[model samples]
Target: MSAGFSMHIFFTRFPLESQFGGAEVQTLSLMEGLKERGHHVAFLGSCPVLLEKCFALSVPYFDLNIGPPPVTKWHAISFLWRQFLMRKKLINAINEQPVTRNEQRVIFMLSLSEKLLLTTWAAQNKIPVFWIEHDSIGRWLRWNPWLPKLRRLSRLATTVAVSDMSKRMYLDLGWNPENTVVIPNGIDLRKFYKRQKILRSTTFHIGCVARLSPEKGVDILIKAVKNIPNIHLTIVGTGRDENCIRKLLEQSTLETHSNDEGQVYHLSPTTSVTILPSVPDIVSFYHSLDLFILPSRDHDPCPLAPIEAMACGIPTIMTDACGTAQYVENGKEAIVVPAGNTEVLHEAIKQTTLRTYEAASVQNTFSFERMIDRYELLFAHSAKL
Candidate 1:
């Protein structure tokens, strides 16, 4: 359970500095877990929120001088060309802390470009790098000339998929099957458990926590609940579709309010919905929900929200495309519905209201400890420690 010797871990794209979501939370959990076990953990990216967090935790952070990825596909060629200099800046940053003979250096990347760009640097230094890909790389890069070389370089490090679905996706894209692994994301069960004396609110409360993108299928959930009487819908997230969702809400309901906490709608005193762009903490929110739904319409690599909710013992309804669907048994830990089927989803919402679905101690398979153990074993073997 211990590294015996300190392993220096530099992780990239610390969320909130650039963006935030499930992968960011999982990365943070991994850093905290490794730090607790006496490993030397440091952040390798920066943003305002990340800086504040790093300072508060006394965790050192270094910015990767690699500029942001292309905002448009036409710019991708230029971005790839600039990675040559970016790689040099990163290597210089990594070398600032001299490595001892006994010290093992690890780079944990959660982004495709970071993995591809750092491969050569890691191979030259003989460091073990891991890229736990949480999203699929867009197909626009498939035809790019730089990708062939990058893919070859990518072979130098391990590619960790967050779920079997992601593993299959990677294999389909010609990733080396031998070097890839599937590690399901997990949460702290102790922190996400249900409250004592479970009680439902006067109105049926259904919840979802995900980025408000079209692929997330939040609109489907809203549509599903639109006709349901005396129910409350709560969504917690922020993304490109925030304005679109707000407009949809304004058209779908009677009363609406927006603030720093996000938006609120009152269909009536007994029927309402609330949307919070973000929350500092979500344990209480999960505990308060009678049902949790993940209505993703696309290949969701691995979502931590429903896992946290399932850990808290909330009834869960998820679409088939969600990566975590493989972990939970249908009709047991959670109910699985086809993605984008508003009729079926709405019916599920109506039928599952006030009912409780147990996770059947899914923590045994997806606990943070279990996830940390798998990661440690991978590193131990890779580091030859």
Candidate 2:
């Protein structure tokens, strides 16, 4: 059966236009596919530009909240305080605002307050709410006070994790296994998998599309690149670790040109390393890459970049920290390495580059359509009251 159910889906906060990450892009793509399949979908969140883009795809949305202003501090303290306040205010704001009873609202949340509001509202009103689990599992467990509330509401709603790792996380926390489903992120095949004339370049354009955070393990990738000569690395996405990454990149460059590795490690960057900001031309981004690397130090539930890269016909090198790595074969679709190990990461990159894997073989099992189809089935089955 197609996604033709007569239902309305309300996603709480969709990062419709933020070029910084993949969650919003996946959400927008899913909404578009759902609309095409005859489901009525709408969103309530910040990112007006992204919201409008989704609307243009015939997925109507309402911007009901605004994100907190960007700040400079990258420490855990900054994240905790800001996230705490943001969630608190958002809960108060959304709670005060009235929503219609007829709407089948699925509150999208990046913070505790949003989760609380949606969970509470869904339980109180008997709405069939679904939590689209994003971010790391550790982050969810970090907030001690909310654990009881989550457990209490666990029976009231169905939770959908983007990856198997995320599903395991909920189960590990004693969440109802019957109430949880694993629906991975998808890609727009028509756009990202289009036929394009290939351009040949000497410098292997190895691309990484992720936030420049320490947890992302970009430094590991850089170290690997230094070991492998004559390749340029392109990092996409912005975050708190920009300065640290720049310094690391400079040191790697110095190491690359220097005779000694130790001497190459000490030099600092005079200018910020030129990192290309997030872009809308994801099709081009994927098309231009020889390899896509996800070097995350923490276990990322289901990262879209690797999947998207495969869809775009580019081979990938992913770490075991990525939950989606389980979906891939070691020597087939993509290579998986230990998290934070530069040696393994470097070897994986070298091997993939040397013996280029067939793009069709890598993409055959992991299409965006397949991922969406799984979600459609899960949603239909779980929507039962």
Candidate 3:
């Protein structure tokens, strides 16, 4: 079906400007694609960062004035009160839109609370809703006791999982398999593609682009590459664990310095490590790397980093915990290893350094065009129902 429908996307977490993760990228790409197809896209959320991005994209949006969810009990009560007020605003915003008989109006939500609130409203109003699931099950929605009761209302909406593994996970969490569909995350080929291969450097450069969190296994990567000769690791992105990572690297350097008793040190450290904040020019970052690794300790559902790196003609190493591992073959497009196993990760990096292979292309499976097409079809189908 062609895409000339009106889609209202509800995502109230980190804004596209402040936190550009896989989910944020997907949302922006999807909205842009739908707009290109002559669809009207609107974002309904309270993230100032996202509002700025929406303004840049020229997409109409409504600000719910909500921030991150609360932590304390008193704050939780205040948050729920704000949500109640936001729901009224949401309903008013939806009612204000001019109703067109020819165009389909649908709600697409990324956050669990927003999905529940909006989907319940949509069900009562006979509007279609699409819930995009980006992670594995056991998230806030599934764990909430109200989920079972909400399932009836959720029947009016469709659940979209970003990967097949995620789809199974949702089903295991009691989502109707028939209502859940697998649609892997996609990347814009224009942003990530193979450049002319550069001359090999004397030192092998390994890179990782992920948040410095425990689940991301950046610490494990640090341990794996410690004291290794002629290898450099560059980590891009920061999180709560940044301090811990810095301490770990400091300890490694201390150990290395103490171990150098009679040996002469070279100008460059045998194992070099650099931690950087997120950059806008990620394509250039991938190009500078000889190899990319995503050593996630959790089940990373359809991570975009590895695919982006592969699209840039860089060989990547991923853990089995990544859902994208199902799409890539070991020793081919990527090297798959056990998550959080520093020894295995270390060995994989060493082995990959000695091996030479052609750059793999993910255009067929993970291209943005393919992803948008699937979403268009789903949106069209949902509108019909």
Top-TM-score candidate index: 1
The positional error of residue 49 in candidate 1, measured at the CA in angstroms, is 4.4
Q: List the candidates ranked by lDDT, beginning with the highest.
A: 1, 3, 2
Q: Estimate candidate 2's alpha-carbon lDDT, on a 0 to 1 scale.
A: 0.66
Highest lDDT against the true fold, candidate? 1
Superposed by TM-score, candidate 2 places the C-alpha of residue 82 at a distance from the truth, in angstroms, of: 15
lDDT value, residue 383 of candidate 2:
61
RMSD of each: 2.6, 6.3, 4.7
For candidate 2, the 10 contiguous residues with the lowest summed lDDT are 263-272
- Residues 19-115, candidate 3: write the lDDT tens digits: 5566666777778887887777788776665677888888787776544443334544565567676567667867777656666677777665556
- Ten-residue stretch with the least lDDT total in model 3: 258-267
Instruction: Give the TM-score comparing model 3 with the true structure, all chains together.
Output: 0.87
Angstrom error of the Cα, residue 378, model 3: value is: 0.6
Tens-digit lDDT track of model 2 for 41-98: 6666776656667677766666665443322224323445655556565556545555
- Runs in model 1 lying further than 4 Å from the true structure: 14-17, 46-49, 136-146, 257-263, 266-270
Q: By lDDT, is 2 or 3 better?
A: 3
Q: Tens digits of per-residue lDDT for model 1 on 233-327?
A: 88998888989987888787777767666567876656678888776779888877888999999889889888888887788999989889988
